[model samples]
Target: MSCSSSGNEAFMPDDIKEKIHNHPCYSEGAHHHYARIHVAVAPACNIQCNYCNRKYDCSNESRPGVTSERLSPEEAAKKVLLVGGEVQRMSVLGIAGPGDALANPGKTFETFGLVRQFAPDLKLCLSTNGLELATYIDEMVEHNIDHITVTINSVDESGEIGSQIYPWIFYNNKRIYGKEAAQILLERQLEGMKKCVEKGILIKANSVLIPGINDKHLPEVSKKLKEIGVFLHNIMPILSEPEFGTRFALDGVPSATDQQQMEVQEACGMDMKLMQHCRQCRADAVGLIGEDRGAEFTKDTFAGLSFDELQIKYDLEARQAAQAKIEEFRFFLDQANERVRKEKEELSSDGHTILVAVTTAGEGMINQHFGSVREFLIYEAGDKGIRFIHHRKVEAEYCAGPDGTNPLQPILDRLKDIKLILTAKIGGCPQGDLAAAGIVADQSYAYQPIEASVLKATRKYFNLPEEMEVN
Candidate 1:
């Protein structure tokens, strides 16, 4: 998940390793099978791109910075819950825009915070112009936003080439144009890229290849991005259309040909990882990459439905799915335990068995915060390796009320057999409370696959001599 401009991938934490493969646009395996949805909650842009036309929305046309309807933070969260229930494979939720996501900071972050509460398992993603990205980098990380895509059209520090692509940028309550704006924008983008890498957040750098303008300069852009440890570089073809009313269209700049795109991609591939399957999706894109469902879930679809009605429907569907998943885990645990009975002694290191509880929302990944988890997946580990038991449901929620009372006591009581708790993060009070109950709390693991974390945890902490041999 972590890569550099040198074309070498360095070591990262386990959570980051699992998050990269879950994103459709970032991973080849995820792109084919996993589904993602983007909510158009941000409608204001801070900078102007030569190829972008914000007024056009054909529904048939698929490109960035275009959407038919803009939803408020609450409405967007409702739509995400609705779509997530229908598309069980939905693993990522993004806020791309009819405008820049960070430009509309209030609305964008409100929607992100809402989705975090609603669907903790869904990987939170955002795409920005990098003008305001550096300012919001720490806030984004606090919100558990792991996947970030920053569109840096040009990295020319001199602003000679960048001035042509971005004629003007609105920064600091002033409209700066020509070289001044370009210099400011380019400097901010590179600074933001460095801050992102320093914080260990996965970044995908996107550059729109404007033929005859910045086409030849993309290789340099890619090289600079790779030096910052950007995980991937996406070279997109610029779309020049008269209807969109852009300088590129008026100037008659031709769009990059298919062969031209491939050539640029191949060139960048030599320096770093090149992403080739970008669809240039709209801000309101839904469903798969090539197949967008934005039109189907337009504002008209929810004409008579109220927010309360949608909430009720979502709760019913979520409850059913939760119960079903719990039953499935119970059945699998029984079977796995039965199969491992014969090999139990061989798998055990010192004949010590312990239960480990992981905070997770989905079947595969540890994608939730400790305070947000309502259920913990329980696994028994020993010489026989690790086996799924049943999930432990907590009566008291972690952040439901004031922190004066011990809300985690009930959860700890329910997980009496558990010796270790693995979560994304835990507060100081809860950590102390858990230790008092003779349970070890580990907050290093987050956004990782359940099976992978379990295997590693057993080997490292449980002192298991041999690999886990489970069916």
Candidate 2:
């Protein structure tokens, strides 16, 4: 099945379906209804990458390696119980670090153990650099960790490209540098991934697209991942803004553009399933893929909470019942979305496609107002159905009134290529600005499912018939 197609559950095996049906990161369809939380319990890394500079107390940043606070195993477990109770849709617990999960093995597994003991129903997973992965496969399996994400940027045996990304790695009580370091890291990454796959653990390979260095080399990496029975491949763009203080940013290496990322995803997607919904999430990220609610439940928030009180709040039976309702709603959504997919196929006979930008606060719906939107989820609607392309971040929320320069202009500049904007509400000023830029803004499908709304709106824009009912 094509990764771009909606509702991929039909191609999934029965066993795999049970594991990923509610896993937001693993299954794209599940993201709308399910949420995942990452605990920053592990804060020690073994390797140094040009793209990474782990930071604590950096709440403004949304990328990987940034967390507001690190937690102990006891504290992490308590947070999980509290969050699981509050965010009932929270189905997965991942220890994706402010550093490497495996690099801080003791803390990583201890947190996992505490969560398993307290909240056994929630699925457990972790993201790692894969340096110490080979040593922990059995332990991971023992802990019931069925899903793993390994960031594998280069598969070149020569280590020429890998050396450019990773300057040095601390291994076996020795610091290895340059090509030798790259070679060892690559060898260990590939070896660990193979071991995990052999043991029936689904592996998601994450490759950072460093433009000049590994842009053209990722297809080979995808080919290798596919050969080893890897489940999914996510090609993430390098975010090298100067404020983040990474080596790449300091050295003035340009960040990858949306076009560059799409090109690489298109190239690598041919080899395996591509994960396009990833937000390049922070280590301490909470709630849905696009939303973060970490601040709501700080360490101080649950300082003196006891295990008995948490267990009462956890309420496994109630959580399961709520999940059942979500599943039923998803069943109806999938059927409706499938109809829209067919409509898109028929409408694309003319071989034309349009880009659409949507304002969403998650839940896979167009629910955010134009003035409050922090980002716009970009999608391509037509022949291939409504496929997620990328997310365009807004510098600041658009506020009405003529206090300063037009806030709408900067937003209009970012969405120059978008044909239509699907939002919950829009004022006359921004709408006029969008019209001046040859873009159409509509609120007719406000609070609707994003994919179906995009498909229907695209058809409406071109005067095409909405041949099928989506809801």
Candidate 3:
């Protein structure tokens, strides 16, 4: 169904289409590419479009809907490994977030880092609304992630249909939008694509065809993108159905049917993938080519995994097996805990308790906040499933409770017999001071009060999900 936008120039000209099909990722969607796994990073989007019914998370699907579950980098890496192994050709690592990926740069980059380290040969790809792409080009380049997908609906901001789709966009909260803002955004996205091409990043576009809205504008989009060096355009058919709820509201406007979709594809020189396998999966969705889930995908089907599948009869047997391994070689940890308990028994005083400092910011800034803080050095001293040490800080900043003489010091001196110090906040100066004072600052706790320091410390903080944030 390949046609042309400019009165039929070269609908995805053979050379360009060959480039796309030759790409490591263009396979799964078509028969050429092997497999694709899209990670849901930032669940928050900047501009709102009409056709986007995807929940903040593509992983948050309803039935096969995985719109709710967002995995950490560690978990995602593990899942990728499992899926890649199962599918036998999961070469593309991608992120089709509910929002844009640039917003979740840390999570996206961290996850990418671990994945690259764990599985180096996999090809990485990311799709964004193109709002923040300009800010993250260097980062993507550093990570060697050149396969990019930018979803651009229309190039003409003044057009009636496009204006309706991009009615009011917000920039810096003031909302400098209308036809003007949409026009500006379109230009910025084009500029971003140019920069991407200059850097050797292959840009694939996803354009949602909403009948009268953007369907006619595909030609200009494809033409402009081609001039800007976009490798391919994937003109997507609008999947908004009334039954799918309020995701994409058409009001009285009907959607593009198979025939209309094909017609639009022919009009634009772009690859249109609405293959039967296109389940409109969640951002963090996972699955085999023709399978529903669990039997093939763990995303919507993780809970279905039972002990029987793991070859264990009961949960206790699995626990015992692991427990046996720990006891055989790592019982010394328990013995060490006992020793610390005995030492604490010697002091037994409330005023001599150690302080715990877990932070979201990194050590340097953490120290900037707390200064020369000292507390009991905590290590993996907790066997309660979470690692941490109870420590004391002698800084006015950390206590958020009190200031002066580091009141926690007396407690630390009392718990001189205590094993470790685990605080919710930590910085570099405090780390150095604590190190000298036999106080260890370990951050394994979830610090809700100050997120920056906490996230910086553990590199594991998810910028509070918007749905759960305080406005």
Candidate 4:
């Protein structure tokens, strides 16, 4: 879904609109065209959440708090220049970590300073637990860090639910635990968030939906976030796998289902603008939200590169021109998508919705082949319009050398609920398997804008006219 459809754009000020115009995580439309990079410069956290398990040199996992490598402020600055030069669409530089950005203020601010000096056009963002956020508001404003994300799970005030999620917190030079710790943390979070909002920084609150723990309580959290003038709220599913070693995972706290997440998002969305496209990116994540390219520019890749060489590559005018072209394409794409949304509303029948999956490598287009797809961006399409629901990650590419196992079966199983699959191309054998499984696979809309294509496909499947009157 695009940001304008949220119904918040009508009331949003011009400055806020400009701030999120090109920010991938902030704007749903920009995510396809723009990219962000997070540097793991801070490796220290103040609070302990039940769902967190920080790990280093961990390239296998894609969730938050996992980084393959940590860098100093100088190294991070150099890497930013290199990536910005290579990936011209890269626009934001965030310092979300294997730890809290606020916990290591020195490193976080230093990195922000260097980036500001060398690549002033790149927007700076920081994500934290909000423990030390109030303390660094001045520094944040000084560094021109206009975007901030705070993970706030509960707002129960009494600290009942918060205590269950957080076992302990190290505050005021002491380890505080239980209800008291939760209360303190919540107080600080609120105070800091309010201060940041007052400073005109766009705040996006992230809440992890733990099934039985705080699922029902999230609506209240969302309401409170909206009351504080938060720009967006993201309800993310808890990733509690046994191998990651999070406290909740070890205790068998099942992760939130996609349905459960959607339900909560529906409830919270009534009070706050919801962000449904988060990829739960890693600390050192690079490139687009759906794809990571950190390994392509590791420390060793630019070992001997000097500051002057990297700076020369960071061409501001060239980046601006490329971004302008992207904006021009999006302007036309948005007009096309708006027509689809209107057509969907007029072609309503019994409020029925069908799930559709698209194979994409970012840039908001169905550009990936079926066999090479590592992930499928799932969308719910119907008379209500197309909305992104989930990101399903497959274990391995279908074309990967087989170990005598039917790769097609796993792909089928994963997409069993899907009614249609939209991709760039599909093999004849796999296409047959998908058709036999009652799933329709289509490649006619290859590399097309995802939402318009999905809605058009949905209309075609339901026997509705592909085009509607432009009234």
Give me candidate 2's TM-score against the actual structure: 0.95
lDDT for 203 (candidate 4): 96
Query: In candidate 3, what are the lDDT values of residues 1-471, reduced to their tens digit?
Result: 212111122244675444444233342212222346766555666777766655533332322223555676766666666665554444567776766777578888988997787566567888787877887899999998878878788888564555677655656565655677687677778778888998988787777778877777777776777678776566666666675554355575575654455456545644332121133445765443222242255454433443233222212344335435533432332332222221212222232333234322211122222323332222121111122221222323334426556644544444444333335445675556566777555544333222222323322222222122223
Q: What lDDT does the true structure give each of the candidates? A: 0.74, 0.87, 0.52, 0.87
> Each model's RMSD to truth, in Å?
19.1, 2.3, 24.9, 2.2
Q: Could you tell me the lDDT of residue 260 within candidate 1?
A: 71
Q: Sort by lDDT, best first.
A: 4, 2, 1, 3
Instruction: Name the better of 2 and 4 by TM-score.
Output: 2
lDDT for 340 (candidate 1) = 35
True lDDT of residue 453, candidate 4: 93
lDDT (10s digit) by residue, model 1, range 236-313: 888787766778988898767655765676576667676654778888888865558778777666545665666554
Poorest lDDT segment (10 consecutive residues) of candidate 3: 379-388
Better of 1 and 3 by lDDT: 1
Error of 3 at 143 (Å): 0.8
Pairs in clash, predicted candidate 4: none
lDDT of residue 61 for candidate 2:
90
TM-score of every candidate: 0.65, 0.95, 0.55, 0.95
Model 2 weakest lDDT span, ten residues long: 338-347
* Top candidate (TM-score): 2
